[model samples]
Target: MIRKLALITPWPDQRTGIADYAFDLAHGLADVGIELDVFTTCTKPSRTISGVRIQDIDKFPGTFAFDQTVYQMGNCSTFHGEQLPVLFENPGIVHLHDPALHHLIAFFLYRDDTQDYYRVLRAWYGARVAERVQTFNELNNQGFWDSPHVTEVPFFDPVLEHATGCIVHSAYAQQAVHSRVPNLHIRQVRQAYRNMQPPAKYNDGEVLQLGAFGMVQQHKHVDVIIEAVKRCNAEGKRVHLHVAGALESVCKDLPDLAKSLGIENDITFHGRLSEEEFLYWMNNVDICVSLRFPTMGETSAVVSRALQLGLPTIVNNVGWYAELPSCVTKLPTEHDEMLKQLVAQLQRVSTNGEQLAQWRAQCRRYAQTTGSFEQTIQDYVRTLACFRTSAMAA
Candidate 1:
């Protein structure tokens, strides 16, 4: 019997991370001949993407509008729109990127009377808004794996049990699902190695070029990178920092940041990048840096992209990043030593391409072993096969 699988990613393409995950996983599932339909929300007038059949989720009720998909395409409520359909249709498995906290919060804050966000809001202002916002706020505040509504809500169980199985990227994520309902036959997957080409790595004496992606979100620690670069430059080090992604809310602040550090010329803020521009910075960048300041240790798909390109990356010591790269220098406490390691890595990457090549090979090998398109598709297919067998028996 032919089995059908539905992967629900509740965000638009440009929102990226899980959305890119949904796309890549869909391709992987399709590579293994699994019948799958990708349901996710997109805002940029419905367009069909390569690999899987994309079902465009309506944006009439968009609450997460301050978004610009920096690394890749935009993503929205494809999962949310298709959630009920997934339940009734009963696909073999339904892989959630994570719980709907981002959606819930976006709906609470962005979904208010100011614009399209407010229309879908169940409560606004006074006690009702306070109560509704409080619930979502608590979810964010408390973090995942331990939430009141996780299992208290019945919808989770059917999705966990009867819906084939679940797939998550990290141990923390897997644990969160298990916490909602114990012993879920879940597959703990990591972020996939992207399909990209590496840039020519740079050296010690050459200008140390650093590329930082994502918006200037307060939580992302973009400022910390600037400060570190400034310190490096102050000590007669040639450092150039390039930032990609949207500057919607952060443009004014970005220039001021450089000016305040007196390194405005040292840093170039590329407002936002198209596919080509983004890749240019990514491929040419001497060091790909992502400073995630204690933000739940979630792994970055962007880092995966860099790995695919064979660009050496430097990320804050988060859950899997330490393990992701064979050669990684942890975020430095002392400015002098940190700069020394940073320069050393750049030299090794540039002069010692052979060593870097070995690490890159490891990256490719790991992707082939654990993250290949075939692995993704086959697992998804197997999950669906099980779901079909059980459903038909019922």
Candidate 2:
């Protein structure tokens, strides 16, 4: 019964992972004969899909006339701030990209008013969390925004208050949303990726090539990966790491850390790569060390990309990463155990050529079977149709 669809997300040229995801989903939806109006915060979208009409979200009408409206909600305030008001006025199916929206709400909703922020926290998270926030504010007044209070807590109740239904990409995210807002309609859809064929053969060079992709932030555990690579070298295995992704101010210490560990030459930090450049490096790497810890209940697009490309990926045994298939190498949660696991993994993949080949094959098979773009398009259409039918009845 769904005819026309309205999609709200950050468009390309914004340089965010969600932007890229929206771009691909828009194209896939258009290909399936769906009439689409893609709304974004960007005044001028740098790229466009052939049958999809891209427009600024400000132009969205006051009336809720579309068959269904889908709002892509993530943890970035700059990208998702404007969409919140529209969501409140006309509730829609919100694609919850990150379960923890503490930073986004803290930065965008209550940035100017300190007291109001605490009041809202108390209302959403109870008095205990509010007291903790007050103590945190007193101790770290200079750097409270990026502190653990903002990063760890899930202050997402306000944003999801008006959402008619929710789409989450991981089991962790689905559970987080349902547990917090028990009555909300929620669906779990694995993040999709293009089905790519694995490389015929990995690099046969002496130095093992490792890659760590996505935003190089503190949570990514890139520093630990660097030390792991150094340990691998010490164990008589030559290893080199290639990091490709957005390198913001928070990641400035990574290069210096590499130098301190005496693995400067073994690692290269390529900041903010273009799509072509990113794919090029991904295709060439032997294994991906995309470790994440203290996760915000977010899924990894880099891990998806690595899987489809038939490249083995290494992730910590936590959050959504733990739910990934056996193709990925899951390290321990403890720091010391993780370091030992990473070193052992790198060494094993380097020497045990047969096991490495089996892992690469497994990755391609799993990636093609589970999270294809075609499945994503179908899931969206089906979910929208069901919601439309429910709306008509209610």
Q: Write the per-residue lDDT of candidate 1 for residues 1-394, one digit (tens) a residue.
A: 3334444454334455565566565566555565555545554513344555555543222212211111111113333534444444443444554432333334333535433333333332235644554566456865222333432221233334443455555676566567755645566555563355444443434576788886656545667677777767776767788988776564459679889889999888887676568777777776677755444435676777776665557865545554564554456534455455555554555455576567556555543444444554555455444432232112
State how far residue 228 of model 2 sits from its true place (Å). Answer: 1.4
Q: Please give the CA lDDT of all the candidate structures.
A: 0.53, 0.81
Model 1 misplacement above 4 A: 1-3, 10-14, 43-52, 56-92, 99-164, 197-205, 248-252, 332-394
Q: Candidate 2's residue-wise lDDT over 232-315, tens digit each? A: 887788899998876768778889988988889999888888888888999888888888877777888888778777788899
Candidate 2 stretches greater than 4 Å from native: 140-152, 200-203, 388-394
**Among all candidates shown, the one with the greatest lDDT:** 2
Which candidate wins on TM-score?
A: 2
The TM-score that candidate 2 achieves is: 0.92
